[model samples]
Target: MPVAALDDIRAKVGQQVGTSDWIEVTQDRISAFADATEDHQFIHVDPVAAAAAGFGGTIAHGFLNLSLLSRMAADAMLVPDTTRMALNYGLDRVRFIAPVKAGKRVRGHFTLDGVDEKAPGQLLIRQTVTVEIEGEEKPALTAQWLGLIFT
Candidate 1:
């Protein structure tokens, strides 16, 4: 993670901050996510069913990919050195543009969208994040992710 002064991010708005290394979306991870969520959707859990249904094999759940943004950010984002903690505030816009098939590698690309002082010790940061699926033209998802950091 890159450490920056709290206010230093203001100038970086609209620019790419960083990108994470690729992570393989394996079947085990997908199955665990499905088991945890109790979502046995054929497209995400049953490779045979999924393969017969049109998808070459099992695919990842969109929400599973969405929920991984924090982990991905932890791997790629810049945080304020003075920050005490950060919170996953909310998202402004989110689109699942494509499916993340099993066995594909994915990575998150982050761009700072804006920053504002929400309080004396808190800063609201808006980031545009795209989860790119390797070897694919279309990204798996594009999201306007929000966070609050306490300094």
Candidate 2:
């Protein structure tokens, strides 16, 4: 799918635009993230402890789930030729609704919330994102994200 034109993109507001990709959240990935962020909480780093504690196993950090947004957004947006560049502006409302256990499979769903012209060939888009964990009732994260695109 090519990137939508500015007008077409704007027209996407109030429309659901969704994409999903399978990603494995492994213990190694979680541990690496923990090391990078210096967050070695037992629930996130100690599988044995976490399992014994009834969570089943160590879980990925909430921020780790948040960090996956860019990857998810790429899957959901960034269609070929839709934009020359897409810059992550920031996020709006974000919530960690559920724990993402290590070794779990997760994907994201996106909906276009708003779009605005920034320049002749640029647009600002607001998208709502939900990171869904396989078999989980609640999503891992829910966030309103922003991005700038050069058409």
Clash totals in order: 0, 1
Off by over 4 Å in 2: 78-82, 119-121
lDDT of 2 by residue, 56-145 (tens): 999999999899887776667633256777788898899999999999989988888988787887778888988899998999989998
In candidate 2, list every pair of residues with a backbone clash. Answer: 3-82
* Full-model lDDT, candidate 1: 0.91
Which consecutive 10 residues in model 2 have the weakest lDDT in total? 73-82
Residue pairs in candidate 1 whose N, alpha carbon or C atoms collide under 3 angstroms: none
Worst 10-residue lDDT window, candidate 1: 1-10
- Give per-model CA RMSD: 0.9, 2.0
Q: Which candidate is the best by lDDT?
A: 1
TM-score of every model?
0.96, 0.89
What is the clash tally of candidate 1? Answer: 0
lDDT of model 1, residue 75: 81
lDDT of 1 by residue, 1-151 (tens): 6789866777788899999888889999999999999998999988899999999999999999998897799787888898898899999999999999999999999999888899999989899999999999999999999999899
lDDT, each prediction:
0.91, 0.83
